[model samples]
Target: MDTSGSLSITHLIFNASPLVQIVMLFLLGLSIASWTIIFSKSNSYKAARAKADEFEDKFWSGIDLNNLYQECIKKGQDLIGLEVIYSSGFKEFVRLINSGPADQEVVMDGTYRQMKVSQSREMENLESHLATLATIGSISPYIGLFGTVWGIMHAFIALAAVKNATLSMVAPPIAEALIATAMGLFAAIPAVMFYNRFVSKVEALENRYINFMDEFATILNRRLVRVRSEMNMKNNDVPQTNTQQPSSSYSQKSYNHPLGEEQHSPYSRARANTHSSPYQTPGVEGDRYRNTSRSPLQGQ
Candidate 1:
C-alpha cells in the first residue's frame, strides 16, 4: 500500500535553495530557446525540402526559361532552392537583353553567372538559422556544467557556515545542485540532435544543388552545340548551293545571318569556357554557395 512517488515540481521548487532556484530559472530559459529553435528549424527545413523537390521536377520537365521564371515569380522569389536558380538565370537574361545588343556568348555567360549567384543566395538563406542551433548545441553543456559547479559550491559554503551540520542538513541542497546538472544535460541533448540533423540536411541540399547545376549546364551546352552546328552547316553549305540559287537571294540570305549563327558560335566557346563553372567565381552569392558545397567545380 506504499503510494509514495518521486517529489513533485512544486515540492522541489519550494524546498530548493536560492542558488538552485536561480540555476533552475536559467535552465528553463535555455530549454525554451532550444525548443523554439527546434520548432522553427523544423519548419524551415521542411519548406526547403518541399521547394527543392517541386523546383527540380519543374526544371527537368523541359519548361522554357520564361515559363519557369513566371511560375517562380508567382510563388514569390523566396521559394527555396530551385527558385534561386531560376531567378538568377532570368535576371541575367533580362540584364543582357536590356544592356543593349549582346551576342549569344555574352547572354549565356551573364545568365550562367546569375544562376550561380542565386543558387548561393538561396543556400545562405537555407543555412541562416542553423548557426543559432549550433550555438545552443555547442555551449549549452558548458553552461549547464557552470550551473552545476555553482550549485555544488553553494552547498559546500552552506555546510561550512553551519556549526553542527548533519547529513540531513547537507543532502537536500546537494541533491538540488544535481538537478542543475541534469537540467543542463536535458537542454544539451536536443540541441545536439538538432545540430546533427541540420548538418545532414544541409549536406543533402548541397549535393542536390550541385547535381542540378551540372545537369542544367549540360542541357545548355547541348543547346549551344546544336545552334553552332546549324550555323556552321549553313556557312559551309553556301558555296555548294550558290549555283542552284539566284546570286541576289544567296547574298541576301548571307547578309541577314542569324546573330550568333555565323560568328562566335556558342558551342566551342562554351566548351572552352567549361574550365570554370559559374559557381567557382568570387561574388557575394558565389562565396555563400561554394562554402556550403566545399567542393571545387571540376569543369569538363
Candidate 2:
C-alpha cells in the first residue's frame, strides 16, 4: 500500500498513462476551440440581430428607397442582415428600369431572383462553424469513454500482479480515468447549446429577409405600373399644331373636303384664286367675276 505520492490534480494528470494523457490533451484542445468559436459566433449573431432591427425600422419608417439604396451602396460590402437582400434586389430593379421600363412581372421576377441569391449567401455565412460544433458534441463522449476504458484496463492488470490489493493503489488510477469523462462533458455542453441557439437565430434572420424582399418587390412593381401609365398617356396624345408635317399626313387626310391635300391649306388658297366660286350668287361682285373667268367654251 504505497500511497506516498500526492493525489493532487497535477499529480493525477502527470501520473496518468500515456494514452489517457493523450485523450485529455485532445479534449482540452477541443474545449479551447469550441469556446473560442462560441464567443466569436455569439458576438457575430448579436451584432447581426441589432443591425437587422435597425434597418427594418428605417425601411418601414417610409424612408425613400432610393436614398436607402444610396446608403447601402456607401456601406459597400459592410451591408448586413436585410440590407444585403434589399440592396441586391433594388440594384437589379434599377438596372432593369434604366435599361428600359420592362413589364412589371419581368422586373419583379428579376429582383426577386437576385434577392433569393443574396439570401442564400447570407444563410451560408450565418451557418458557418455550426457543423463543427455538432461534430464535437456528438463524438466527444465516446472518445472520453475510450480513454477511460484503456486506463482502467491498465489499472486492473497492475492489481492482478500485486499479491495484496489495497484501496490506495486502486483509487489514484480510477480517479485519473474518470477525469477524462468530465473533460468530455465540459467540451460538449456549450457546443450543443450554442449550436441550437445559433440555428434559431439564423432562421429568424432568413424569415425577415424574405418578408422584406417581398414587400420591396411589391413597391417596385407599383412604381413600374405608375411610370408606364404616364409614358403611355404622353405617347397617345394628339398634337395641337404642326398637322401638315409628313407624319401627320395620313391622319389629316382621313377628314377632307374631297379636294385633296390642297383643301387643307396652301393648295386650297391656290384653287380659290384660279376658279370661279361655285357658291356665288348673281349679285354685282359675283356677276363681274363670272363674266371675266367663265370658260372659253361658254357664249358671252
Candidate 3:
C-alpha cells in the first residue's frame, strides 16, 4: 500500500497529462505561497498584539501625556498599533491647543479624527495580505476540481479507445485524475482554516484598538475641557481695564462740571482738573470727600 501510494504521488505526476501536470504545479505554487503568507501573518499579528498590550499597559499606568508623546516621537515610525493611535490623538490635541485656545468640542473632534485615521492605517497594516490568503482558500479547490474534471474527461476518452474495458484498464487513469481533486483540497483546507483564524485575531485586535481610542479620547477631552476652563478663568481674571477706562472718564467729566462756578459747584472742577484721575471711589465715603472738597471751594 505504501509502495502504491508512493507510485501514485511520484510516478503518476511524471506520467500525468500536460494539463494535469500544469494544474498540479499551479496548486503546489499556491500552497507554497499560502503557507508563506500564513507564517508571515502569524508573526506580524503576534508582534502587533504584543506591542498593543505593552502600550496599553503603559498608557493606563498613569504616565504623563507629554512624556508618552515624547517617547513615541523618539520611537518614530517603529511605533505601531495602539501606540500610534495614542500618539496621533495626543499630538493633535497638543497642536490644536498650542495654536491657540480652541473649543473643547473642536479639540476633541480633531483628536478623534486623527486617531481614527491612525486606527484605519494600523488595521490595514494588520490585515495586509489577508486577501491573498482568502483568494487562495476560495479558488484553490475550484482550480483543483477543474483539473480533476479535465483529467477525468481525458481518462474516459482513453477508455473509449479500448476494445474492452476492465478495472485494470480503468483504475490507474481514474486514480491519477482524482489526484487533482486531492491536491486542491490539500492546498485549500489549511488556507481556509488559517484565514479564518487570522481574521478573528485581526478583529480582536481591532476591537481592542477601538476601545482604547474611545477611552483615550475621553481622557484627552477631559484634559482639553480643563485647559479651556483654566484659560477662561485667566481671561476673566485679567480685569477689562480698557472697558472700565471709558466709564471712569465719563464719571470724571460729570464730576468736573466745567460750566459750574467753583463756590456753587457740589464738587470742585479744579480738583478734578488737577487730579485728571480715571479711577474714582464710590459710595458714602466718596460723597463725604466731595462735600469736604466743596466746603474748601466754597470758603475760597
Which sections of candidate 1 miss by over 4 Å? 1-8, 94-109, 235-300
lDDT of 1 by residue, 1-300 (tens): 014744455665657777777877877788789889889877877787777666655554445555566677887735677677866665565555445435667767777877788778777977776787777767767776776677778889878978999976776666676777778788878988987877777777777776667555555545545545554555566677577765442232222212223334333233334443212222353334434533332110
RMSD of each: 9.7, 25.7, 22.2
Candidate 2 least-lDDT 10 residues: 253-262
lDDT of 1: 0.63
Report every candidate's CA lDDT: 0.63, 0.71, 0.70
Encode model 2's per-residue lDDT on 193-279: one tens digit a residue.
988877777776676667667666766676455445544454457485755556532343321121223354322332244343221
| Candidate 3 segments exceeding 4 Å error | 1-7, 234-300
What is the lDDT ranking, best to worst?
Answer: 2, 3, 1
Which residue pairs clash within candidate 1? none
Cα deviation of 58 in candidate 1 (Å)?
2.2
lDDT of 3 by residue, 25-95 (tens): 99999999999999999888888877865775566555556666778999987998888998788777666
Compared with the true structure, the alpha-carbon lDDT of candidate 2 equals 0.71
Q: Which stretches of candidate 2 lie over 4 Å from their true place?
A: 1-6, 238-300
Each prediction's TM-score versus the true structure? 0.70, 0.76, 0.76
